[model samples]
Each structure stands twice: as structure tokens, then as C-alpha cells.
Target: MKDKLARNISIYRKEQGLTQEELAKLLGISFQAVSKWENAQTMPDITLLPALSTILEVSVDKLLGYVAQDKRITIYEDEYQTEDYYWGTEPNTACYQVLQLIPPTKPLKLLDIGCGEGKDAVFFARNGYEVDAFDVTNAGIEKTRRLADRTGVHVNVFKADLLEFRLDTHYDIIFSSGVLHYMKPEYRADIFDNYKRFTNENGMHVFNVFVNKPFIAPPPEKETNAYPWQSGQLLTYYHDWLIRDSAEIVFDCNSSGIPHQHAMTTMVAQKITTSP
Candidate 1:
């Protein structure tokens, strides 16, 4: 919470065009105090929260790393509202790899990051893995629940923004598909670290990211938040982990009814703990 508050203070303060000195002046404190708060060295007094939040134009909950609620946050929010599944209900081919690599001989916990419409989550749940899934869109969450209900499976689903959500619980597997690109490059390191830290020993992370290739044209849909990665960039973060599989592929997409090509990288990595 302290770390989140510190980061929020700095981020919001900068967004509001206020320097540390200016914020300190507004709060009737020394700039060093504001610096301390932003550096996570110390927290502000409870009494000063209101003024600070007001100045930063952010909710107190947000500053403390608690998301108030998800709104119409994604480009796909409206697309997910219809009776038909926008992305369809089929699980990605990569899901089968998960089943093969880490078959649930016993109960295993799996988390689906950005589980659009919950097809994969429900699939995992039906396959005997405990599944928890979240997406930024309310419609997506509803559709996911509907799919799970229709499939006679219970997929624990919720709504959360990828940028603000962090994992604090352990899981045997973490899976995400066609979503990591929505994460701003600046936050990838911290988010990946958080994901890696919370994974149980020998737990696997099956993830795919859209990567930039000179031959591939830009995606048809212009995303405000998309940052296509470079080749081999994702592997750098897993230097310590055993990389089970990694591949790059070029594929066609017709999401917005326009033909386009995308280069994507998929990686399956396992966290291994060695004896000292």
C-alpha cells in the first residue's frame, strides 16, 4: 500500500503539472516531505490525505492501490456486450499446451489475465483446474460468467484494469493471451516481477504478446494503450527461469473487419527453485 501510494502521489502530481516543491507548498510542508512520500520512504499524515488527493485529483483508494471500479475502460467493452461472443468462445491453441505440460493430476490454481469473455477460464475450470479470471470490461466479465454458466462450470471472474491489478496470491499457472500488449511498456517490468514473485515454485507462465515486425502492418484497430514488443524482449525478463518453449509467428487478424497481419511471440516458462 505504501509503495502504491508513493507511486500514485508521484504519478498524479506530475500529471497535474505540479513539481514536488509546488505540491509541498500547497500542503504547507517541505519539498523533502513530498519527496519522501514519493520515494516510499515515509507516508503522509492521515489528516493530509484529503488535501493531497484533492490536489492530485485522484481518489484516496487509487492512491493506496485500491481500484475504485472499472468503467468503460477498453476498446472492446462495447463489442463484448452483445449476445455473440466478440472474440468467440474457443480457447486459444496455447491452452492445450498448458493441459499437456501441466496436466492437473491434482488441484492446481490458474489465473487468466485479461480473460476476454472467459472462454479459457471456463475451459480450465471444466478441466479440473481452479480458475480465477479478470478483465477490464464489465461486459466481458458478464459474458464470461454467462459462458461459464452455460458450460456448467464455475470460473471465478471479476473486472479489473491490467495496469492497476497486481497478484498477491500464489498460483500454479498464469496464462494470458492477446492481452499483454495493452500494458504500457513502462509498467511491464514491475507487473512481470509481481506476477513472477507470486507464482508457486515450478509454476508456469503461458503468455503471448504482439511483437513489432517490419514486414507486418499496423493492426487495424488503433489502440490508445497498445505497445507492441520487440522480438526477444520478453525472454530477457525470464533469464533466471527455465524457458520451456518459445516461438514467434505471423498471423492474420480481422477484428475490426479489416485485414491485417500481426507478429506475435508466445512463451511458456517455469519457475524452478534450486537447492542451496
Candidate 2:
């Protein structure tokens, strides 16, 4: 692990165009310490791993040279080729509730991850927020761009896979609807941590995930693209943040033209300060 960390630290630092002294200054440590870590003469404290990984734009697991097995991109691309809005055309109810909490007088920067058809992205742009939205498929991104143009709202749309997506700018509000649940368990927490890092102080994050419930069964055997979260797991990730709202509800979904019941965990949290 130490050897791997050393190799990754040197590799990532160079990849970011940061010198040893620059990296040490960012970490608030001495250059000697940075040199030692890369030389495998010493290791960073466990508590510093999160900050180190964040600075390097990677997960701690990746910093430790562990790779995540992600296989959802093909599934999403195939789905997008056949359907325009797999979720729906309208913004989810959670999005409306989150908008009400934002200050009406302020024009904040917003990011809509997994923004399909740009419904929520268009809604935010039309309401005076600067919006950037992205999805895994070109089809979804194209639809988002077209919707924004038709609505006379300005929204930047791009194609990105969430598993490999990196934030280039911090946002005041990051909205992701019905997206994180598809992630593998090991990758979900790291993604949320990254979201927190890319959110400015006092910024709010609003998202929803499928959670386990007696009444809501798993997807059919033929469905290989679903991952359900355990009840209350989402809230645990926001222990250091101010939880504005949280709820577990059963809802009906007809995104695929077949009606089904879904149990979901919805949450809105504000980052008041850096995590300890």
C-alpha cells in the first residue's frame, strides 16, 4: 500500500502540473514530507488521506492504487439511444422543493448531474441560475441542449459518465435526480464526497436514490443496471453537513412505459464548512 501510494502521489501530482513544493503548500505540510512520501520513506497520516485524494482529483481507494469495477456506461448508452427521457419530461418534485429553499434574489451557479432531457437544468436556467448539465450519452446531452434552446434559456450541456466525471468548477447548488442509486456501493460514498468538495461554502446538494423497502422489489431479472441502497444509508454520508430535508417515500414510475412502484430516499443538505 505504501509503495502504491507513493507511486500514485508522484504520478497524480505530475498529472496536475504541481511541483513538490506546490503540493506540500496545498497540503500545509513541508516539502520534505512530500518528498518522503513519494520516495516511500514515509506515509501520510490516515486523516490526511481524504484531503490528499481530493487534491489529486481521485478517491482514496484510487490513491491507494485500487481500481473500481464500473460497467454501467454501456447500459446507459444503450438506454439513451432508444429513449429521450428515461426518467420523465418534468422535473421531479424534489427539485421544486429545493428551488423554494434557495434565495430568490441570488443568481447562483448550479450543476445538474445526470440531467436527462434538461428539464431541471432548464428550470434552473429560466429561474436566473447559471446552469451546467451533463449525462452519459450524447443523445441525452443533445436533448438537453435542444430543450434549453427551445425554452430560450441558457444551459451548458455536455456528455460525461458520472463514474469518471470531474468537476471543473464549484457550484452553489448541485442537483442530481434519481442518479446515484445506480452506482456500485464502493463508489457511491466517494462520489458524494467529491460533490461536497466541489460545492462552495453554504452550497446545497439535492438528490434522490432508490432505497430498500418491503413494498418495493428489485428490478426484473433481465434488468442488470440497478443498484438499490439500504434505508438510511444516504443520510449517514451527510453527518457533517446541515440536513435541510430528508424523506423516504413510495412512488409510481412509468419511465419505461410500464408502471412500477419505487421506494426512494430523497435529501437536501447544505455544506456549512469543511469536513473535519
Using lDDT as the measure, the top candidate is 1
lDDT of 2 by residue, 12-60 (tens): 7875789999999999999999999998999999999999989988888
**What are the per-residue Cα lDDT tens digits for candidate 1 across 1-276?**
887788778767866889999999999999999999988999999999999989988788877768745245568987887899888888999999999999999999999999998888988998999999999888888999999999999998987778767787999999999999978776778789989999999899999999998887788787877777899999999999999999999988888998888899999999998853
Segments of candidate 1 deviating more than 4 angstroms: 1-43, 54-57, 64-72
Give candidate 2 regions above 4 Å deviation: 1-88, 221-223, 274-276
**lDDT of each candidate versus the true structure:** 0.89, 0.79
Evaluated at residue 246, the lDDT of candidate 1 is 99
Cα-based lDDT at residue 91, candidate 1:
90
Q: Who wins the TM-score comparison?
A: 1
Error of 1 at 140 (Å): 0.2
